[model samples]
Target: MGISPLNCGWGICVFLSLCLISFTPPCDGGNILVYPVDGSHWINMKVLIEELHARGHNITVIRASTSLYIKEKSPLYKSITIELDKKVEPFFIQYLQKHIKAQVEGASAFTFFKITLGFVSAFSQLHLLMCDYLAQTLDDPTMVKSLRDSQFDLVLTDPAIAPGVILAKYLELPLVFNVRWITGGEGHFAIAPSPLSYIPVPRSGLTDKMNFIERVRNVFFYSIALLQQRLIGPHYDAICEKYIEGGCDIISLLQEADIWLFRSDFVFDFPRPTMPNIVYIGGFQCKPAQPLPVELEDFVQGAGEHGVIIMTLGTLVYDLPKEVSDAIASVFAKMPQKVIWRYKGKRPSTLGNNTLLVDWMPQKDLLGHPLTKVFVAHGGTNGVQEAIYYGVPVLGIPLFFDQYDNLLRLQQRGAGKILHLSEISQCFEQSLMEVLHQDSYRQNMQRLSDLHRDQPVAPMDQAVFWVEYVMRHKGAAHLRTEAYKMPWYSYYCLDVVLLLLAAVTLLLLSTVTMFRFLCYRCLRKPKAKQH
Candidate 1:
């Protein structure tokens, strides 16, 4: 009679909560060290770091003092900032401009060679700079001691600039890479078996299925990567010799990683041979749309049934050339759809009432908005993945460095259209209008979204599970292949091929000798009988 109904309900709820808590497995977290490449790659690394930190692990980021995007102060991770002699930030803009100019002028064979040589020279120099920074980091006694004393469970790194790979080896820690591009082109080329017959080389601008000319082009570009690697390898080899005990190369170190949380999956990337340790975590950063800011929400809603288009060229190239911008602005002016362009360029004289230019954007939130119909992007991995996540069709304007290739995959899937800078002035209106009116673009993208979403585990959750798996297991040596330790000649079985060829040659020679000896004896016998 004294027990109240409210107290009975509260007691029941408490019992259920206690049961649920008891059944949930606890996260046995460990200390994790992160080595991130700044800019867009950092964005990827940061997402993984956020998840790892949320799971009750400690994170330490090794950053360069000259880092563009990475901050020295952050609540998420303790940073060990390394000193650099000079910042290459200003040089990047110059490089971008020159790269654009080179692509435009690449109509001639002379400029093609010039471009290839220029690229090799520029990248090799940049590789040298990264090596120099690694040398500095290693040379610092206090830095090395701090890293060793930390006794981290693993080193999480973006291997685009692979100081982290070396550091992981030096510290004798378990290695995990948040990777798409390693030191040598695409990550697959570093560890997986990439057959040039079908798998197009990065920057070759070809797809999986290629004709004769395209195959030649793939070989040519792959040759370029090989040459560049040859130039880059010596630098890393020297670092391995100096810093790493027992001496290991960058490629070997990469192959030895405990896990590769690759930011690509079969949904986006072509089907290719992959190893067990490679975990596909595409679209891990994508989530349901958060409510936009009041003004931006009003702008999106203003489009009504016509819907809206979102365009961004990422952080590096916010401003296009004046001519290109004018052409784009003029085209946007003609569209019935409202446009939110993330541009920092001079206001185009042709910019219309339907268009709004902002310096920054909540890109993920905007893409996830229901009214977002078209995404005009530079075909970044993140942007493309987000577009796929939100089921938004794309109108791609690829600037440089895998951007075209990224869009090409979407285009091949019938979900996007690519507008090269060279074509923007003449055909921007045509390309934009085609993508705007095309129903298939939206339909195909939605299909991809469905497939990507129809996974057993969300990509982010899968990625976090793998990270924890490494920590719990100490390292994932069982998943790793022993092919890395084999000599190139043996790995490809060139030795077997040579031995087989040698045996065939010997058999033929013996047969020929026996035939000649029989003929000689028969002729001698005939001559003796005649005598």
Candidate 2:
């Protein structure tokens, strides 16, 4: 039964067509997975998710809370817990492990630390998960496996969660890390000051002895860390080898990424590394105005020419001490212009006629209004970006975390002033007066604001363009750096052992030459005596 040549060729073509159909990803509904660090919906994830959904992508949101859903109801919200175990689907584990192995060897030391810290910060994440009221909706292993098997097109993630990132890698999905603040750049600490110029020298400059003590303290602490790493390093090494080949190569992930969207203005000193993948998409989410709420509009209009000042301490740090509140109230009472505060807790008893305290306010909308003069803030990145967007100068009362760093940049840029927690009374009042009365701060802020707004494309659009570029290019390996593959010593060019050997050889030769010259001179003296 000999098959005819023409019939065989046609059969092969039909077989290949079916194979292509089976392998191709479904275009009818592309999944866009959102992986927020627990309860981090407020950290620009909400807006991004909404935007992605609006663009007609089928979204499967893997978040850590119901608090996010409480304010905004959407069909896309998938209440899945992020905890991964053997109970998870076998296929997902296989995909994730395989995917991570390919990328792990090229990760940077910094990336390694960030991914490890994600594991260490589990307590913090759990706390947020509990606080945000999302403990019950965790995704079971099977569901996660099923989703991975389905093969999503893109993963929008926060790098603080290594597991989510690893999952993205396993699924071969295009990923984007949402860096909420300007924490990666030098001097721009997430929760503290950088160890660069600002060595923990006290502000008074009277503690020379303390600096020595601090140095010794740091050495001892680092020694302890080394000792611990030595003890557990082998175990971790073994585990990583067993699971993710080459373990945690975070640097490779950073370099291989399509683009890094920094939500920071140029005023933020983003330690400019020579990398093309980094993009300053500083105020992507900040949109220009819609008219203010009717009551708020009338209130601003009624203020006549004195205008308005807005005071807010963002979401997490809203719990200001009563004394601090009293001090702020006292200062605001003295100002001629009207003040509107988004004080979340109890309203103060001593409210003046010109002041209004509300549980919440449309912060960006208020800042965008023409009558708003100054901002008193906790110096959160979003607030800082908004203030910069609106060209309104700030009086930063930085309490804790990266607030201090953000405040410092604003002060250095001449766009704002910083008032420490202890010196808030004198500093805050004085700074507020200067910002309002003097025109330089406002003018400088406006100049910077204009530069930020004048960019070629809006930040969010640029972000979307890059995301699509990654998918189109099938991971964009052209953007990845070769530097990531080099060993630490090779990268630093430390051939010190070879240099030491060369120095020893030269010293020995020089000594032998000197000895020979002296002997010859002595022998010549003897010959002269004999003559």
Q: Give TM-scores for every candidate, taking all chains together and pairing residue i with residue i.
A: 0.92, 0.71
Output the worst ten-in-a-row residue range by lDDT, candidate 1.
522-531
Native-vs-model 1 lDDT? 0.88
lDDT of 2: 0.61
Q: Indicate which candidate wins on lDDT.
A: 1
Q: List the global CA lDDT of all models.
A: 0.88, 0.61
Task: Report the error of model 1 at residue 510, Å.
Answer: 3.6
Model 1 lDDT at residue 1: 57
In candidate 1, which residue ranges exceed 4 Å CA deviation?
1-26, 102-109, 112-116, 511-531
RMSD of 2: 14.0
For model 1, residues 205-279, the per-residue Cα lDDT tens digits are 999999999999999999988887888888889999997778878888889999999999889988999999999
Residue 4 local lDDT, model 2:
100
**312, model 2: CA deviation in Å?**
0.5
